[model samples]
Target: MNEIKKVLITEEQLKARNAELGRQITEDFKGKDLLAICILRGSYIFFSDLTREIELPLEVAFMHAASYFDGTESSGKVNLPDQNMLSVEGKDVLLVEDIVDSGRTLAALKATLLKKGVNSLHIVTLLDKPDRRVVDIDVDYSGFVVPDEFVVGYGLDYDQRFRNLKYVGILKEEVYQ
Candidate 1:
């Protein structure tokens, strides 16, 4: 079993922040055609919590875009299967993500969504790790700016484990090493 080094963000903190983010989104997108897209696997928990908080009639969609394939480091190439089913044309899009690290996945998805004729695009992430970023990308709504560490929980995972934890925690280095 993998051990956690420390709890980085508590469950209470995440709940409070999610509520705040929802309010901000509701105000910004009042009466607008908003489409919240969840970057699958990692962002499922966060996407569900955040979308519920938004007090607006917005559409929700899911797309699978992966850069880290069961590893801590990104493979540098994003794998996006079929996104043709999503209707993004003339709609304000909010890409919901669990964390933003290397920025490659989000960057690629942003470009693809824009090409699909989205009226506007914005990103919302549960955690942001600027130190690990390899590409320039902007996160519109960020719950927390985390240090470059191997964190897992609340939809974040290591080899598809630890996503069930309610709060974010740093994984013990020995487990991964």
Candidate 2:
């Protein structure tokens, strides 16, 4: 049975931070052709809330990418089964992701998008676990810097469960073992 070990970020904190990020993005990308690409399965919740808070007019798209294969840690290899098919030529692209852990997934996705001749490519993630980063990557906006722990909730999951939780929390060690 899976159990929450600790609440890392509360729902209240998420709401406040998301609002701030929205305002910042709106200000930063104002008057630009903004195209927000949400890396799905984990980022949908954050993308939905964050995009709604952006005051500027923008377009949204979903790209299903995965590096984790039903486990707590990444498989090192990133896969984008659903390729980004939108026309990104000369458009400022913002990749919204739920977490930036190993950074492999984001790096691969960024490389792929860059080939599409985007005007600019930026990354925004709800959580960042810098200690686990195998590839160096910088995020334009980050909601929280978490420790090296297995987290689940607020769209993050373990074996595709616990995503519906309102707050972000660490999963019990026993759950993933």
Candidate 3:
């Protein structure tokens, strides 16, 4: 069993940030073909909220690339359950992710997307954890820069739990230990 240690980000904050990011993305990609690809399982909530806030005619897709297989630590191997589900050829791709931790998964995904002949590829993550980053990858838009704590909620999970929480929170240390 686990408990929320403290709230890292409130729901209101998330809503406001999403709206801001949406506006920025809308402005940047105005009059251009945009395909927002949601990195599945973890980023579905953020992608849904953020995409809805984007007042632009854009398409959406999903990709399941994960490095953490039911654990807090990254296994350093990206697992792509379905890779060829969408076509990104000659389209501006907006990769939506829940958190940018080790950067391994995103780097791999970015490379794969680029190889498929995308016009451009930009990353947008709900949370940015630079402290734990191993691969240097750029995040075009970031909602929050969090510390090196085990965070959960807002679609981020611990053992596939706590993802439905409305706000982001830190999980108790003992829970994962």
C-alpha local distance difference test of each model: 0.94, 0.92, 0.94
TM-scores, all candidates, are 0.97, 0.97, 0.97
Per-residue C-alpha lDDT of model 2 across residues 1-177, encoded as one tens digit per residue: 249889999999999999999999999998999999998899989999999999988988889999998677789889987775678889999999999999999999988999989999999999999989899888999999999999889898888888999999998898779
RMSD of each predicted structure:
1.1, 1.2, 1.2
- Superposition error at 142 for model 3 (Å): 0.4
Per-residue lDDT over 23-81 for candidate 3, one digit per residue giving the tens place of the 0 to 100 score = 99999999989999999899999999999999999999999989988668999999887
Better of 2 and 3 by TM-score: 3
Clashes of each: 0, 0, 0
Mind sharing the TM-score for model 1?
0.97
lDDT of 1 by residue, 1-177 (tens): 349999999999999999999999999999899999999999999999999999999998999999988668899999999578798999999999999999999999999999999999999999999999999999999999999899999999988889999999999998788
Q: Report the error of model 1 at residue 42, Å.
A: 0.5
